[model samples]
Target: MIEVVSLIDAAPPRVFDLELDMDVHAGSLPGSQETATTSTGRRQLALGDEVTFHARHLGLNWQMTSRISAYEPPYHFVDEQVRGPFRALRHEHHFEDLGDGGTRMTDRMSIHAPLGPLGAMVTRLLLAPYLSRLLRQRAIHIKRLAENVDRRR
Candidate 1:
């Protein structure tokens, strides 16, 4: 499990809403080339909503289907993989109100590689760093957008 924490200078509700915005999530990771394969295109995700993403990574096309398994308003949500490249993937987003128009956001990802010991080795040596970078990049993107501009405006 990898935990990435971020502080965004925005109200908890705003941060939480942005976190579930499909467009913001997709746009933040340009390198992944991820796109929603659903008919709704860019839409907000709610509890029990399943989204399939098609992405090109490592010069290979990959697909992952994730469903919003748990949701708590203005607080936290969890998305879990139904089928994907990874053996198992669970992403949890947690938020805390700082009482001064700021939010403390925490993203925790629990991912399991497919090939047992060999896959674990590969994950540790390669996938871990790449995923970590992507996670930090996404956090920064959210922070900037929340602090500087509102994309929904």
Candidate 2:
């Protein structure tokens, strides 16, 4: 499991809404060429929503489908992969009000590599760190979006 915590300079509800916007994630990460290919067209994702994505990782193209199995509005949400390269993948998002117009966000990811020991070794030596950086970058991107969301309001 890889966990990331971020203090976003935005209200909890604002950050939560931005976090659920799929469009914000498009092209947010470097070199992934990420795109939601199926089960989408909605403005924001909710419980039971599934999105299939295609991206390039580790020099290979991959496709994964994830379902929002759990959602609790401006508090928390969980997305689990139904089909993907990994043996298992679950991402949980948690947000709490900071009492100062900001939000404390926690992102927890549980991932399992295929091929057992070899995959585990590779994950520990390479994949985990890479993913950690990727998630942190993603968080920064979302935080910026959330903080600036109401600029036109």
TM-score of each: 0.91, 0.93
Please write out the lDDT profile of model 1 over residues 69-118, one tens digit for every residue.
99998999999999889999899999999998899999999788999999
Error of 2 at 54 (Å): 0.7
Best of the candidates, TM-score: 2
Report residue 1 deviation for candidate 2 (angstroms): 1.4
State the weakest 10-residue window (summed lDDT) of model 2.
Answer: 144-153
Query: Which residue runs of candidate 2 sit more than 4 Å off their true CA positions?
Result: 38-40, 151-153
Estimate the overall C-alpha local distance difference test score of candidate 2.
0.87
Question: 26-143, model 2: which lDDT tens digit per residue?
Answer: 7577579888854767958989989888889889998999999999989999999999988998999999998988899999998899999999998889888888988899899998
